[model samples]
Target: MRTIKPVQMRSPVLTVRRVDTYHAITVVAPGVAERFRAGQFVAVAVGGDTSSMLARRAFFIHDVKPDYGGTVEFVFEVRGRGTSWLSECRSRDLLDVTGPLGRPFPLPRDPVNCVLVGDGHGASPLFPLAHTLRRRGCRVDFVLGAAGAQRVFGALAARRVGETATFATRDGSLGLRGRVTDALPQVIEDARADVVYGVGPLPVLRTVTAIAAKYGVPAQVAVEERMACGIGLCMTCVLPVVGDDGVTRMLRSCVDGPVFRGEQVRFDDVGTIPFDALGAPGWKARPDDSASTEIGQ
Candidate 1:
């Protein structure tokens, strides 16, 4: 397979259809939009510069209108330079982007009550998963967690798509002011879930996964990591992957995943994206600007 190169492509200015501060972006990029999946991501060349990596940032595809030639929308948060750039971008400006990379959410093999937990930019990937599950007649409760009112997004949009929505803000601005896990007691009490969908900070994912496991519920997490060669060669996006044998392997998050089972990941190594092999510099980690909603995908 040819590694997707930044050099040989014409960046498109994805006209903003709409924008949600700290929540989502609706853009019209029909060419790359149609091919994306819920857990899969697209690498965006910030400011359309191919030379210096502001790195090709990855976004979890939130809404994919296939009829619009795959024109899609993205919902995420503003964390650093790249994302900030994404926020400041004008409607008609062109930017380079690539692929529906990595594996998608595991469509549950057995039907069970599904609870979707969204935190920070982690919320982006679950939109499609929630919608698809609801269509299949599964009962889904979507809980969004944020530091304050500013971090939550698309509640009305989520409801329209068929998920029963709730919010847990740390500041108590609108909903519960505790951690996502803190809301679990009441949430799970109302409904016994078979599966839990989570996207958010490492600590949150760890806590969510632990809670689900304690209750015998299967949990899946949408993982995001820093990327460079979106196809995996750069190894800039290495995250722990669990194989059938139960051993955690460091897989290139770019190609292998931006999605992993909650139980399978090693959250202790969350942000330690190896700049060198075991922190050495001879094989230094490239200066990476490319990032995702979470950095362990």
Candidate 2:
């Protein structure tokens, strides 16, 4: 019979420092913040109860700070029952948390015109990415997309890390008055992006992948998959992948990666393939939003 191993864990009532509606959720989890990485995630049990949750909800690490005991950060749109619960908690309430899970985004080998594209909560991880890129002397250009201006990244904050940045909104309520993908041509053309990294809706990633392919720019994506165990034991969230040898394979997005190259992922084959065939429970479509789209595999 399948079983769950006991994991020694800590719970804390994280005060909600700030809420960037479309951008992120800044939490004051002092000791846990600095430990996470860009693209990595944490599984949280609201109100410290996992009984009804079945599986802890996974959220993107987004960003963390070493100070304030290193508060961990997550940016997500309110789309499900778990998060709606999260929204109800008071500023200083603790949560049952486990993680620093999932593979992190890749750091550039050398400074290239790295383009960071993310929309809404997907934009969370770009902070560290942009920071790391700037530290390495790589020119960074960030393009953020969201429903409206209220749903955007920390603008002045991002400008502090990246050299140049742009914004686009679906309702034309913000920067470009269009989708992030719509501003790609302009962002790419203006910044001369040579390496591209993205996190957002699958459709957004798909569009980014195509643009990168057309431009011959090396790009990577942080894929969001439903995860139950948060460990490799559950074959619930396997994503089709190609190995270094060019052979097709299956990889667990929760463990092996949340980060994958634009080329390695079988994007076209995702929703089409049967789940049982891919070492997962069943084909559960995790549509667009990377936030609420949980892969309870």
Candidate 3:
């Protein structure tokens, strides 16, 4: 079992950079930096102390460094009011951050050929994971895609870390003109990948999972779901998943996963509860009607 040390701190922003389609912020957060693993996320309290936004914004940790005791970095696009406020933040500004949360990507014990797939800003987490794999003597191949070149995150970095890096863009601004899945088959075949790891939008992840299955390679996917609380209490990010015991249940993405084996998830039934799930209507045992009727008589 893994122990997580979560801390709520007013971390000082060390640096901020405006990447093509998003903003990357580095903060002086020792606890998060020291404890963070690839695929875990941080929940940041946006709009400062008196602001009206009650929920925290979640972001995947892009990187962590040893600088300033420790520093954690995350990248985000301004999709809404919360992220807009985060984008306007300047260096030395104090922001409330809670983090090192969620299950990290499980790594293989022995070195193997691995292919990593990411789409848009979802590519952030793959760099650190690739670094770890390379350290273990694993050959890492990267397949990254976006609508255009600017939308592609970590292209140069992926090239630097991976043994072979392939890109796909919808508008033909970079590499191939298609989705990541379009480029995946050739990359996997050429690399002779033994396993696959992916993080991205639901559609992209589903496609990646399908491709990996067709190739007979195992896949692990980190899903990007809309999280309101970033914790398990809200029950807002639940999705239907099958367990090892052959039962299906609604699992919270924030706690139960964000990372799950590709085969275990029923991608077609993600948004709605399956009729056969444990707690679904008519699935649970009902009280005996005869006993109740006799008491009433």
Candidate 4:
């Protein structure tokens, strides 16, 4: 896997289209598009130049087109003020964007059977990834889920991109009347998937990881976190992850990864640093504080 240095630029909004229950914003960003990799994302400066929102909102690139040099598309739901302001932007409006950040999904060296799982707007990144996987002679199957039909992001595109696309909605407004995980085990068995990839809420990734492990299939997952800087400088998005040496360390999601091996991530310890993690406070006292001595003690 390769990571390219990102560029910060003010790109004009090409279009803002509403798809399903999400908003898809396309920006004219040649630099970002030129370096764009599947599973990578862009950080957008919302609320305009004079606005008070200092934290940049990160969104995964849904598509990149070669129109007007290059254009990048990202999807989001208007949950708060940042996204609410973004939803109001129109064609010809300019947006400050920096991308294609974070470690992208690593492709296999040889063609393999791959199952891609996504929930809600998290399905955006998987579209580009699915296309790339197919080009490498891999069999791609999709398991997309959401709360309801309007919440499912890309049913039509998933159908066109993968060999088979299965959908589940809680409200039974889509294919199967359940969540993606409920339908995943059967899909894995039927497809004989060699590897699994997922992008969604933390809970979803955690469940997907467990299911993939049960089937003895390798999994790579992209995590969604509230990135304050989107550039690793803030240190606000650290999570405990096991290194190859078997030591758990706090790693930054913005730089270390938005993508990681499913089994290595400490999913249950995401929001808080684990006490046993390397360099964590009181790390030396975990097993036996009675025997452990401090510098002055």
Candidate 5:
């Protein structure tokens, strides 16, 4: 039971490096670094003090190190103005960061064979997760995929941490000539994976969930949704999820989870509220519309 504390800090950038397809930044935020767990993320205010970018950019914690007391690192692609601003960050520049947010990936109570699946920059969180899993005596395997060679985040790191690591690329520039899902079944079978953990785009998660289900292996997924307020107040990152009580409701990814039991999520209806979901309009409507009849009638 890890308690989450919401900390806001102005931390100095320790270092910034241009990875093949993304920028990696290390910031001296001891509070965040000490408390961070896999799947938790940080919301960074970009564009400096005078810039107009009000929305904080969210990134999964790539790694944490005990330097300058403690430091946290995150990786991201320069997808837009916010990230572009982040890219220009240099050593000693201060960044306003809010973090150690969101529920972390749950490690099993007993050691089990686990397969981690990540795609593109989404692979950021898997490294630390692998370390934790390995320390707990779990046999870890990795299946990482990207559009091309440079886009793959941690092939070398994966090999270092994982018992077995497999890579895939859409352009055949890597280990396999397909998506991660294409190589998943073989990996799962070879590893005799007892469970799976995945973090990536929704489509990739959906596929991983489906494959895990097919093999009767449990799957946990961390969704990558655009979050405005990582603290969950905004309700901007809601997605339909089915609870154990068998009711489907919109859950906020920021708080309720960015990580969830794969089978419990309505992946196909993520963007649209399902007609039968709890609290949905007309969800309890009578088949004959008798409930709408006037009392006088």
Candidate 6:
């Protein structure tokens, strides 16, 4: 859980720029910047005050700058009306933002060999995480992937930040011609990684977890879930996760995670609650015709 409480404020836009295939927005959010941890996210209210769009768009905190009091930057690809509106935002625009939300990536207590994997804009958070790891004496390596070269975020930065940077593109437009996961196993092996960290869509995370398991290394993954609210109040982002007690519970991604032990997540059961999950219907009893009839009566 986060020790710093998130604050909602009308933050002033500091910069808006196009970064290859993504848009990067920096806002003057001192509160968020000061308390931010890599892998945490922010939710921005779009469509101004009167527009009908109700849900706040969630974005990972890409980076933070200490200048001008403090500022937080986030990157995104404009996929719909809400994001399109965000792209048009200019300097000095006041956007309602709430963040440094979600549980952040937990840092290791001792320096170790680490491999970080990212996909598309999901690579945003890993850059900052790599920096932190290096400062803690961890050797950082990167495996970044996207559909094409232009879509792969932070390749040049990865080269500079990591001990070695490996890239994969499905179209053969970059490093290796395959999914990022295709490059993951080799990177982990060569780096002699003690731990693997990943950020991407659910399927990618699932594959990353499997690869780490094969190498007998622990995996920490940040998941991409459609969050209706960036707070725990909304149950929209719940996913099945096995706790230390071996109980499968539907945990909220916003608060309980966006970052979780990769092995503990029931990735295949993400969209549906597992029948045996705690509190799930029929977890204790098998539903049958007699039970249904009794309930009806």
Whole-model lDDT values for every prediction: 0.67, 0.71, 0.88, 0.91, 0.90, 0.92
TM-score of each: 0.80, 0.82, 0.94, 0.94, 0.94, 0.95
The candidate 5 region of ten consecutive residues with least summed lDDT is 288-297
Encode model 2's per-residue lDDT on 1-297: one tens digit a residue.
122232324545455544556424456654455456567788777545444766677788767776556567776566777677777666666677776777777676787888899887677778877887888889988888888887887666667677777889888877898889888877777888888999887788888988888887877898767777777788788777755544345777777777888777778777544342333464332354232322222
Clashes per model (N, Cα, C within 3 A): 7, 12, 0, 0, 0, 0
Question: Best-fitting candidate, measured by lDDT?
Answer: 6
| Model 2 alpha-carbon miss at residue 269, Å | 0.7
Rank candidates, lDDT, best first. Answer: 6, 4, 5, 3, 2, 1
RMSD of each: 7.3, 7.6, 6.3, 4.8, 5.8, 5.6
Candidate scoring better on lDDT of 3 and 6: 6
lDDT of 4 by residue, 1-297 (tens): 444899999999999999978999999999999999998899999999899999999999999999999999999999999999999999999999999999899898899999999999999999999999999999999999999999998999999989999999999999999998888998899999999999999899999999999999988999998899999999998878887656677788888889989899988888888888777888763453343211110
Model 4, residue 181: C-alpha shift (Å): 0.7
lDDT of 6 by residue, 256-283 (tens): 8899999999999989989888777877
Q: Give the TM-score of candidate 4.
A: 0.94
lDDT of 3 by residue, 168-227 (tens): 999999999999899999999999999999999888888999999999998889889988
What lDDT is reached at residue 259 by model 3? 84
